[model samples]
Target: QTDHYNLLKRSGRAKATTESEDKFLRVNSLRDRWLIEQQLQAQLNTGRSQQVSVSTVKRRLRAAGLTGRVTKKRLVWATKHRQWTTEDWKTVLWTDEIFGSSYRVFHSLQTWFVASTVSSLGL
Candidate 1:
C-alpha cells in the first residue's frame, strides 16, 4: 500500500481519500468486487455518488455473494452463491482447522479463526 501510495503521489493523480479518482475510476471491476466482498451498506452508500443507481450496486453485491434478493434484471441462484456442497464445506473446515491455530503463534485458535475469516473474506 505504501508503494502504491507513493506511485499515486508521483503520478499526480492523488486526491482526497473520500473522492479520489482511484476510488471512482482507476479501480474498475476490482473495486466493485471488493465493495461486494465488504458488504457494508454505509460504505456502498458513500462510495458511489447519490445519482448512481442502486441496481448497479446490487448487481455487484449479488455477483459477490453479498445479496440474496432476486430482481427482474437478473436470475437468482437457487441458493446463495456462497453456499458450498458438503464436500466443499468439509474442505473449508479442514483448511481452517489446519491453519486456524497458526495465524499467530500467540493468538487463540478461536480468535484467529474469526479474525482470519473476517480479514480474508473482507467481511
Candidate 2:
C-alpha cells in the first residue's frame, strides 16, 4: 500500500506539487471542497498532463496536512512600529506563529487632580 501511494505521488497523481509548472503548484486557500476542486483544475490546466480529480486533490492536500482552516496572519505589531498611542489604543487582536490568539486592550494613561494652591481662609 505504501509503495502504491509512493508511486502515485511520484507520478504526480498523489502529490499536489506534481503539477509544478512554475516551480511548485499548491492550493493555499481551501475555502470549500468545490473551490479546491476548481483550483486543482486550474492549476493542472497546463495542457501537458492529465487533470487531477477532486478526490485526488483532496487526498493530496490531506497527505500534505493542508486542512480546511483559515490560517490567521501573525504579526508583531509593536516590534518595529510605534507604541500604541492614546488615540489609537482602543482594542487589540494579536497572533503569533506559534498558533496563539490573544485579545487585549490597554489604558496606559492616568489622570489625577490635586489642590496645589489651597486657600488659607477658604478662598
Candidate 3:
C-alpha cells in the first residue's frame, strides 16, 4: 500500500548534497517492486536513464539486493527439472492414419443420437 511517487518524493526531500542518489534508489526500488508483482523477467536499475549500459544495470540491480529476483519462466508443458524422459510422455499418442478426408459439418446440432439408436432397435 505504498505510494511510489510520494515515497520517492519524501526520500528525495531529505537534505543532502546528493539528493538525486536517494531519489534514484527510491524510484528504482519502486520500479523493481512493480516489475516483481507484474512477473516481468527483466532486471531493473535505479541508475539507468537510457544512459546506463547493460553491465551497469546488472551491477545496480545486484547492489539493490535484487539479483536473486531475476528469474526465467518455463513453458506451460515444461517439467520441474526441465529434463523429459520417454515415460513422461507415455500418455501422449501420435496417429499417422487419417480417419477420413472430411466429415459432415453440423450446425446447431442437438440430436439425441444414443436414445434414437436404442429406440430404433425396438428393445
lDDT of each: 0.36, 0.42, 0.38
- The digit string of per-residue lDDT tens for model 2 on 60-117 reads 5555445443221113344444676766654545454455332422222111112223
How high is each candidate's TM-score?
0.20, 0.31, 0.26
Residue 10 local lDDT, model 2:
45
Candidate 1 regions exceeding 4 Å error are 1-50, 69-123
Provide the lowest-lDDT 10-residue window in model 3: 106-115
Of 1 and 3, the candidate ranking higher by lDDT: 3
Global lDDT for candidate 3? 0.38
Off by over 4 Å in 3: 1-26, 32-50, 73-123
Model 3 over residues 1-123: C-alpha lDDT tens digits? 665544333434432213454345435544544333112212332333543344544344454445332222222234364576788667668677464222323221111111234556887
Best by TM-score: 2
Identify the leading candidate in terms of lDDT: 2
The collision pairs in model 3 are none
Question: In model 1, which residue pairs have backbone atoms overlapping below 3 Å?
Answer: none
